[model samples]
Target chain A: MTQRISKYQRLKMMNPILQFFRFIYLSIKILIVVAGGHGGTRNIKSSTSSS
Target chain B: MAKIVVLGAGISGHVAASHLRRKLPKEHQVMVVSPNSNYQWIPSNIWVGIGRMKSKQILFPLAPLYKKKHIGFKQAKAVTFHPEGDVTENKPYVLVEGVVGDSKGKQEKVTYDYLINATGPKLNFEATEGLIPGTNSTYSVCTYTHADHAWEGLSALIADMKKGKKAKILIGTGHAKATCQGAAFEYILNVEQELRRHKVRDMAEVTWISNEYQLGDFGMDGMLLSYGDMTMKSHEMVEMIFEDRDIKWILGAGVQKIENGIAHYENLDGEKKSETYDFAMLIPSFSGHGFKAFDKNNKDITDKLFKGFMIVDANYSPKPYEEWSVQDWPETYQNPSYKNIFAPGIAFAPPHSISKPRKSKNGTEIFPAPPRTGMPSGITAKLVADNIIDTIKSGKEQLHHKGSMGNMGAACIASAGFGMTSGSGVSITTYPIVPDYEKYPKTQGRQLGKTFGEIGLAGHWLKLALHYAFIYKAKMKPFWWLIPE
Candidate 1:
């Protein structure tokens, strides 16, 4: 079955002006998520069991 | 002096060698042994498959870069693992066979103080009958050459469509347990847009066939994504995209064989079915290279080194799906038996698949294997390099540096179209790639805000920008280390 999407949402996805803002917004959001993942090593108790 | 050897020249191996060479002193040595002479930015292969980019634009020779960086390079493929010294050689070394030039077919024991097995999956196109690429109208995009062939086949089909010959196009997993659904997803979107660009949209029907039980399972059991002001399931987002583009889908399909222009598959219902297509590009199953390892006495000890892929510090106990935990994942990709050896990226076998296992009514297992590509590959490689550097300098065994998919994040930008202004992209950022039910306990075991999805032209821009950025980093350009994995 085909999915239903609001007409407004479809327009917004293609709107150059709105998409530019989305571009800026996504850039900042991704930067935050990616930065949080860096140097993300933690000291876990080494497992003893073998595969 | 210490000599570090890294196998394979893919993202993980290349990243590990680069970091090790940069961080370690000139006195120590860093060498890369790879069958491939060129380092290609794999993520950009999608663009090549759609004819938006060329193979040369995505690859560069590795010899010159290694020479300038003082990192040794060997154009050879590892044949056997000799973790312990043999009768003739007392040091831990790997037997590698040269692939080209005067050393072609020659075997040499490459010694190393520490070894990193980053050899990625072997594209098992043979697993599916009559699925050989460039034959029976089936194609692949797992490599640059494959992508080029796909584009050629597709362009020809597009030409036929423009001449009033209606066509059927199929894309998705070619095997019962294939991964890289995201790559196939990206390619389908690009192919759809390319058809529109060539003004043959109405002349061709595009369909997505996958082993996923539902749309957007993506081999990670899908995600609860925060899309703008709303929270939705990954399947919902994918369905909306496909619906808007008027694409058809076949789920729970285990493609068993391909014959001429027809694909035979068994569904979850155990019913046999077939789909006819004028052209197809399907991702094949990824399997281990079946590498054998031995001890100092030349006794066969392959089991100690491999269980399909290399054994790592993961809890690989046989357990049911509900009993699996993120803790079962590997933190340090070090081989337990040989502490001096490590297998990062796809080289390390996962304890279990992130997605729940499923079986066809006929008792055939069909589900996606875990994916260890792109971001995760780079991160794991860097961590392995850091731990090795620490161990070498401290003059002791060090397992300090660690990261796991259970806690690490990955950003996947699926390009729906290709262009600066008209292009569209679907961006999904998933934190702690493996679901942590105990930590989050809700929202599908992921932090909602961090695990978000967005669709717009910006996503395409980000993907293209990363294409150039990663190529620069791979070339070790000025201050390339400043870029994160």
Candidate 2:
């Protein structure tokens, strides 16, 4: 008997495409931070940024 | 020209060596001595444990990288430290035994003007009976090899589950004073997620056992994060997740012994009990790498170390938990006895535990010790390297910087699975990692505005990004130094 695949599982199955978009999104976020002089390579500090 | 010798090539040591090589003049020498030739990014070992990633993806040869950076590398284990050199030489030196390559079993002395002890931890599997990997009843995810072994065990269990066999899985810290509960937390979630993905979640009973007094203590006494206009404690947050996932937990547990499939443990109430498991991954407590130190008079200065860790600027005076203060922690990592020596990462002795100390009715201490993970380790390494660079440039010991955990912040992403869209992870950032009561004046001892925690697919994406980004940075690709520690 085949188990029913849920919506979450279906979304997960499309991870390859989601992962590509996520990569582009994160790259832009990194660029923005670097452009704003908050490069990822700077010293550790107490700041918050979302991916 | 002065030479700086870095002991161990783990995260902290590698970071220090890389920075020193980049900043110091070519005339000055920077060298690293470590047992393994391959550097393993330990954070990804959790993924490797579940066979989500291969060991080769996370492990890389260090010799090529060191050669590219023009830094001397030795595949040897530091056996002893001679602060006061022998009669032939008056300079400080360390005796190391080659453990890899053609120099295996050969011992040599490496002299230095300054030393950085970042040997990381010696996983004390022997501290608990039946905890030894390969020969033991339980498994570990502490190292690449250990994770491989764990994956084998997990695969076998999953195969049985596919055959309609029910199995009990126990995952957590193996010792009473163990740290790195976060790794165990990550592993358990990954395991649970993997079981679900295999369509066998109902056939497995997953349980968590730890020395944490409460869930999500995470060895920093837990932090307070604001959620939907209500302040939430870490334990409360963790409990909600555990309850939703139907994962059972035994908190305040000190695992005393393991025999076959049974783990003998003692809880805070002093009650002794046993739990059975068909498959288990228990993280061991860490101790010093066991390098002996001596003074000019030939007297053992090894006593300068507490429980195998080199004592630094921290106040090591014996005191009760109530009297423990922020001043007790090391602001500067320099050894007071030997000013030229610094111990960063897990090599330095923590003054006291970050979690509130607790004892069982039988006088057994059961509390999570503080953790110095990759972020803090990298930050401290950079600070130590910078201080050393200043001293080298000025030709004077100018210890002008400190990177104490009490004043720093760290970001951690705990991955639950490897799926891009279906994957999930928890991203947590805590400022002033160690609680400062005076600064925050809150019950949780942290700034609520600065502490944050979130769980979603985004965190998993970030985790994957960091794994690749850090490896690229460590490999010293173009502008690697520009990547933040």
Candidate 3:
């Protein structure tokens, strides 16, 4: 599964236009996460709660 | 209460100080002493140089942010280090001359339990006779002011091109030992893109000149990246790009000197040549920020540094390239002389050239010095901060972390323009920035599988995103710590 994903990623990178769209897609997803206030919270909860 | 003093508020020092303020107790103080009050996100200087972004857009005052984070801020330049207290005092303190604020130009002493020297490169424009900004033949994009000036020069060139006058633009490293070929590469491409945007590309002659043995060396030697079924070296990809873009290049050329629109350089063949240009943007070589250190007895320990870079964990055994080993690289950025002092980022002297050291037939060394840019510099800063925090807690240097460039990966997005749909950029990631021969024996010092590159509008977007994201993080917004280095 990991290799398949890697190969897919590599293929996406080979075409500049495709990669641009992929990045735009990824950027949109990231923007959505940021808007949802979950963009940088993976370890925030654990680290802050412990502190 | 232990007080930590961090000199310079660059990416490395600012990040280290921010982390320390968050992790350490209120009793233990974190103080940052820097000459500049505004933290300039330097990577975006390329955009600023091209006139797509303003200097004000990329700068944020450090005082307010540090105050909000409860970190002490001193706008001052560090003059000297007193590792062992002077005759009047017994505690280690740094002599600083205030550059801003109420105490501007005033001399004062600040004591520290731990010291982090993160004063970044001193732009040695004087190294070349005509490289200085106001009195120079060539311009630079290394700083916000310099970038603004470069944009002004570029605007004039563009104006000439529009008037049907052919413009020659020479862009690359100004010194034989200069690093940051990446910046020059981006600058030249962006200039070309700008020219095309104005329909004046045909009127402008773009040329790249560098000290690298080949194109895309980027000071980590050249990397090998996979492209579809075939693997390609960086030089091959760069050549293709240059050919497609109609850009001319001169590699393995050490820029000897520059005078009024004429740059004299020597190639690897020991052949000297000169190129005249209507405009040029040359990246100057870096040196230490000129700081002297002293022992308790007031004995000068200036030998602790070489060419202004603090010598760290590596064995300083001067050996030729044939005898260079991976162990010569510093695993931990701790200064051997002072356990409490750490020089992360470009402050630390690299062990040796990451690229295979090369020389002309006449024996003139022409290889570029290693570059410690964004990713590797940030990782090293975090590691150094963690180790310092541990040492403070245990009352001894108990924790150690290593983020050597030889075992690290870096991502670079070189922007060609700042447009939503019309712009383009190149994204590249290379593993173990310094090639590790032992781990990947077959790949000639690097892991070929982990290195790759791509170009598109998406790369431009990514670069733009990073510019904002890093500045937001540097300002210590909520959950900023979660942002990867």
Candidate 4:
């Protein structure tokens, strides 16, 4: 089943038009991650714990 | 009660100091020593070089910002480092030559419990002749004054071209060992853009001269794009773009001298030739300034340092390029002799050349720096501070830092035009640097994913917004903490 998924992923890159859209999709995904990221990987903490 | 002193006030210094402020105890003293009164985000200097931005917009006075953070600031240039205290006098301090205000060349001593020598590269204009005239010829844009003068020179050249006179502009570093080759590349491209926009590009001829083995090397030992071997092929990309704008290049050449309109260049094969230009902006090479820190024996520590650059906690040795393992590089930027001493940014030396360290026929060793662009350098400073603070608080050997330029992934967007489109910005990201020799034994720093530059409107917005966003963060506004370390 994993082999089939790998094969499907390889097949998707074969089409240039699809690949461009896929890239856009990936970047948009990354853009969301970037937007959501607090700028860096360092964990942020608050002085007064609310929970 | 540990007292720490940080030298310089550029991006790397500010990043280290600002983060150090948050990491250290309120009672623990923190001080910043620098020659400048303001903090300048130097990456935008390309725009400043082309007159797109003013010196005021790019720099902010460091005094007020330091005050708000309860941080002590000194506007002075350090002249010497006495790492080992003189037991005879019973006082230990670094002697500094004050350059700010009426001190205007007064010398003073700054004592510290721990010191960070983040004094960055020196713009050794004296390294090249005729490139900086009276004593030399061409103009420079390495600092506010240099950039200011370059802007004026560029405008004058533009005015001459508008009047139907021929103008030739030469842009590149003045020496073979210069870092920041990317900044020079950015300036030459911006100059080309401005000339074309003014419709005077046809009346002008622009040339680039550098010691880089190839264009776009940016000293990162060659990065890859999604396409493949981008470094080997970027010359074609520059050639295409240059051809489109009627620009030319004198690649793999080092500038020897500049006398008015003539520039003497040594070709890749070491043959010297002269090229004439109406205007030239040449970046200079760097040396460690051989700062003196002392050992218990009072032996001078200058020999351990690189010229103009401060030697940080890094393993220094000549490892073969084929054996260039990431493990050989630094993760935690702590000084080898003193744990409190950390060298971040250009001050810290990479273990070996990013490009295979080379030598001349006479065996003149040339060590090319591993390019640490402004962004990554800032990150390294933050990480170094974080680790130091952790060590201070825990009183145990804290986890060492590991922001290796070789293993780190980096992205750069070289602007073709300052507009709001992807077509306007040429951006590329490379990853898993130290190209997995096991996976791809033949290459170094090759890309696993596609490294492509998309030219569109959005890239321009990202670049401009980044300018404001980074400035906001550096100012340490309320949201600055939200912006990231």
**Per-residue alpha-carbon lDDT of model 2 for B219-306, expressed as tens digits?**
9998897543677888887776677567899999999898989889999999999999999899899988777787766778788644
What's the TM-score, to 2 decimals, of chain B in model 1? 0.99
DockQ of 4: 0.04
Candidate 1, B323: how far from true, in Å?
A: 0.1
> Of all true interface contacts, what fraction is found in model 1?
0.41
- Model 3 chain B: lowest-lDDT 10 consecutive positions: B398-407
Writing each residue's lDDT as its tens digit, candidate 1 over B363-408 gives 9888888988788899889889998999999999876667788877
Candidate 4 residue lDDT tens string, A1-51? 012223353344334455456446444532332222111112113211100
Worst 10 residues of 1 chain B by lDDT: B398-407
- Candidate 3 lDDT, tens digit per residue, B1-485? 99999988998998889889989999999999998989998888888888999999899999898888889999999888898879987888999999865898899989998998888788888776678763444889888988898888888878888989998899999888888999998999898889898899989889999999989899988888865467888888788777767789998987878888889988889988899998999988888877888878888877864446887886568888777665567766788877888888888988788877778777878888888887667777777898899888988884346655665667777886668776777777776677767667777676665576666678788988899899989989899987777
Model 2, docking class: incorrect
The CAPRI classification for model 4 reads as incorrect
Alpha-carbon runs more than 4 Å astray in model 2: A1-51, B305-307
Error of 4 at B105 (Å): 3.7
Off by over 4 Å in 1: A1-7, A38-51
Better of 2 and 3 by lDDT: 2
lDDT of 4: 0.65
Candidate 4 chain B: worst 10 consecutive residues by lDDT?
Answer: B450-459
| Alpha-carbon lDDT, every model | 0.90, 0.82, 0.79, 0.65
